[model samples]
Target: MRPETEADLADMIASASGPICVRGGGTRGVHLDGAVLETGGLSGITLYEPGSLTLVARAGTPLAEIEAALDAEGQRLAFEPMDHRGLLGTSGAPTIGGVVSANVSGPRRVSVGACRDFMLGVRYVDGTGTLVKNGGRVMKNVTGYDLVKLMSGSWGTLGVLTEVSLKVLPKPETAAGVLIDGLSDVDAVQAMAKALGSPFEVSGAAHIPRGLNGQPVTMLRIEGFAGSVAYRADQIASLFGGMSVRVERDPETVAKGWAWVRDVDTFQGTEGDVWRVSCTPSDAAGLGAKMKLAALLYDWGGGLIWARVPEGTDLRTRLGAFDGHATLVRGAGQAKFQPEPAPVAALSRGLRARFDPKGILNTGLMG
Candidate 1:
């Protein structure tokens, strides 16, 4: 089922009799048994204001279109959303609604924020076929319920988003990456924490235990004016005086390198189940050590761990209890998301009941 208009979408949901699988771009590797509701029919950019640093696009508007428009104005989506096509091997144009639905933020998320942070407004259809619009096209909109945020990262379980308004940032004049080699996972986390804490403004930090060349590399990114970028890179490199640090100043090289980290390209085509682990930065190395995975990639300065283990491995069982959560990003036979605490689980159930009384939207996808 595909609806081209907001009213049509609402009506379609209202009339649906069975479970519905909400899909946008078809790139997230989500599979479920239900009637497919494709949002691709609702496409196009509705508004864009370079001076105001804002953009509004329909849910199915191709992500590339938005980025190209933003680039023409020397602006960009500050959250640095990841492209799942390479990692998931899905062939479809990513859409703005998909990004918002998944709250897909990339490496710069450590410094800027997640996709939800920049969201200004959203228009979606709830389970009962009601059209809901919350927030607005401004940064300081504080009217009623903050449903704009609630819709984000909801994975379309609550509603199907029709349009979204976002805040954008000016593109940097230049960017550089400082690469530190030969550091163990523990040492890499420590170095990343130090770099992030420094006043030099590191925008991206990641560690690949095994990179394209089959060597360990810790990357730190700085962006701004050319002179500022170069100065900050030198300062950050100097912080690790005795370590092997190489500064990459070429704009294209820096962008490509960070894209690699943002998309978890290290494990893109590799064999095994992939897990996305979120924990306190200081506890990352300990958790990784416990898992003893086949490969590892650290992002967000160690706050996020991507582990590749043998297929059908239940990583949460091996790690025992910790102050973090492990999510299965690839492979099956186990739950994908970590089980919420009792209190949180109750609250989640309550919200779902309230939003989707019929429980027809993307049923059982989250679990």
Candidate 2:
């Protein structure tokens, strides 16, 4: 089922019985047993103000469309949302609604913030087919309950988003990468931490256990005016003077390198279950060491670890208790999301009850 208008969407949900599978672009590899409700029919940008760095678009507006519009204005989505197509092996164009629902974020999240931080407002339909609007087009317009943040990262469990207003940032004038070779996972995490701590404003930090040339590489990214980027890259390189360091100044090369890191390209087309582990930067190495991984990629200055293990591996049980959570991104027979603590689980149940009394939206997807 697809509805082109907001009213039509609300009516469709209002009249629905049994479960409904909410979808946008169908890129996230979420499958549930229910009638499918695709939001693609509700597409297009509603508003864009380059000077104000704000954009409003329907839920199903293609992310490429929004990126193109922002690029024309020398701006971009600061969160640097990842393109999950390659990683998930899905072909549909990613949509703004899916980005928000999943709270998709990339390497730059270490410097800026997650997709939820840039959200200025949101319009969604509750489970009862009621339209709910929260916040507004401007930051100051957000007051009272901040449903905008709650809706993000909800994975469509709470409601079906119809429209979104976002705050964007100006594109950097130039960017550079400082590559340090031959660092072990622990050492790489330490090096990345030092680079991120320095005043050079590292925007992206990642470590590939096995890089393209079959060697471990740690990357630190800096972006700004050309001169600033160059100077900062040199300073970062100097921080690891004893190690083999090379500064990549070519704009295309830097962009491509970061994109590869952001999208977890290393694990693409590989056979294994993928797990995204979120922990403190200091704990990342320890967790990775405990895992029996086939491949690993570290991003967000080692705060996020992507582990590829043999199919049907129960990573959570193997790792035991930890400071953060592990999410199954692919190859799932076990649970996809981490089980919440009893208190948190109760709170989540309460929220779902309030938002979706009928429990018809994306039933059992989160479980």
Candidate 3:
């Protein structure tokens, strides 16, 4: 029950006999079932070279503070991690280290990649009580291995990340989203694919399938300068012809529109079972084709699907058709987890074991 300072982590690891969870702000507290290693006290920015476009901060620093400082200089962490303020019923002050530990990348992930991409270096206390450092403040060649990337989405399973260094990108001059309405799941996927492949860079494309009575999916987002976005919107519109595409402009409007895509305010399925299914866009349409009663929808250009089903149905059988896997997001009583970790996941686990031999961080979250 102690807050880990830079020096204290080693001692903390030495004392713990079993697995340790790298707790951060306790934002996702309920999701874990282990000894908590709270990270909020490990706060403050260590180094920020604005000219270098790289910054280093303690793992426990609040993400909002990081964003505000970067925003002041017209720069930002490109992956755009979403704040689970509303969803988890906790303060939106997610720690920067927590973001890295969980790899909380948002819609911008479609373009800039995830939190792992910006990771330049890390300082962590591994299991068996070892404090190690890797990479550098600036990007360059590595001699052999890279644990920074390994810990990006490890969900604190490997080691307790104490400090993080990342390269940031300037915020776009202008950003906007073109909401192409009425297109069913099939048409939306085709449209998103087309926009993403075009000359103009469409940063994000999501096909939010109609849910419940009349909720329409918030379609594609195209960023960059206003003129370029408008031009791209027109070119893509030609493909749709008569279909009504609602184009939204300005940062405020764009921010409001992306709320759903960001999973900001819509975590209401807490009352029932919610499943987050990740699959290729091609298979999404057919995977849940037989579910006559489940309330389901799609997002992230149809690659991420959200479904809330009646309590008793077996999720493994229901979502087996889709080539991808589903992780339970809400509601009661079941181990609907993907016990068989994907090949990539096993490789990730190996990397974790390499960094954390004692299995003293986020033990069962990975299992």
Question: Model 1 residue 153 lDDT?
Answer: 96
Sort every candidate by TM-score, greatest first. 2, 1, 3
Q: Which candidate is the best by lDDT?
A: 2
Q: In each prediction, how many residue pairs overlap at the backbone (N, C-alpha, C within less than 3 A)?
A: 0, 0, 1
Encode model 2's per-residue lDDT on 15-75: one tens digit a residue. 9988999999998888998899999998999999999889999999999999999999999
lDDT of each: 0.93, 0.93, 0.74
Question: Which structure is stronger by lDDT: 1 or 3?
Answer: 1
| Per-residue lDDT over 239-342 for candidate 1, one digit per residue giving the tens place of the 0 to 100 score | 99999999999989999999888888888887889899999999999998988845899999999999999998879998999998998888889988899999
lDDT of 3 by residue, 237-262 (tens): 66667877776777687877676667
Runs with alpha carbons beyond 4 Å of true place in candidate 2: none
Sorted on lDDT, best first, the list reads 2, 1, 3
lDDT preference between candidates 1 and 2, better one:
2
